[model samples]
Target: MHVEWRGRIVVDPELHHGEPCIRRTRIPVSVIISSLADGISEEELLEQYPKLTREDIRAALAYGAELLQPKSI
Candidate 1:
């Protein structure tokens, strides 16, 4: 499925010691991804963390994919 992944994902040595986060929020994308990896469903995620949205989750995935992507030399 086509997903809209925005630039909300951010990483900086000054922020969270360089861990990937959801830009404005200190919530790490890795945390969200890990939760899902541990079998946390989308609906459960939203319900558990009312502060997160579907888009946020998608952005995290996109950010992770970008990190793993091999850069063209």
Candidate 2:
């Protein structure tokens, strides 16, 4: 299944060298994803990045998952 990433997730040349990131912040989506991979819970994520919401993290993960999918020929 493919998830449509919208809102907080955005890609901008000025942000993280064009890496996907939270729309208004310099934080890269990879940082969020890696934290989750390392067993950081949503609450911990929120605690670390006070401005980040659960939805933002979910969107980042969905975007990452979409990137990992095989492209159809």
Candidate 3:
């Protein structure tokens, strides 16, 4: 199955064992979230992962937030 989160994040069985990742990049969304949780700044993230942009970081956050929302019956 193919899953797209916030249009910028995607999950494909062929990549990272199907983990959600930024589109066109191998960087996993969980990695971004974890890094931020560990106190990494957005600028630092950009510097560390040059392939990522500010919008990509925001998309990761938005995707994570969407997952945390309650599911309706």
Candidate 4:
């Protein structure tokens, strides 16, 4: 089974140990976020992950931001 998040991100147990990744690619969201945090520019990221787009990067960021939000219980 395949699960999609933020349109461009996906989570599949068969892939990357179910870590959220870019749809159709095994690149995990955490890697993308970490790369950006480590001073890797968007251009560099694009070069490194050709399958990803600006929209995909933005979606990953949005996903990360949502995860950081406090849940209302």
Model 2 stretches with alpha carbons more than 4 Å out: 1-3
* lDDT (C-alpha) at residue 31 in model 4: 94
What tens-digit string does per-residue lDDT give for candidate 4 at 1-73? 2222567988899999999999989889999999999999999999999999888888888888888989999
- lDDT tens per residue, model 1, 1-73: 7555567777888889999887677878899989989999999988987788889999888877777989999
lDDT of each: 0.83, 0.85, 0.91, 0.88
lDDT of 2 by residue, 1-73 (tens): 5456787788888778899898777778999999989998989989988888777888899989888989999
Report the CA-based lDDT of candidate 1 relative to the real structure. 0.83
Q: Which stretches of candidate 1 lie over 4 Å from their true place?
A: 1-6
Steric clashes per prediction: 0, 0, 0, 0
Looking at model 2, report the run of 10 residues with the lowest lDDT sum.
Answer: 1-10
Candidates' RMSD to native: 2.0, 1.8, 4.7, 4.9
Q: Estimate each model's TM-score.
A: 0.78, 0.87, 0.91, 0.90
Candidate maximizing lDDT: 3
Q: By lDDT, highest first, what's the ranking?
A: 3, 4, 2, 1
**Candidate 2 CA-lDDT value:** 0.85
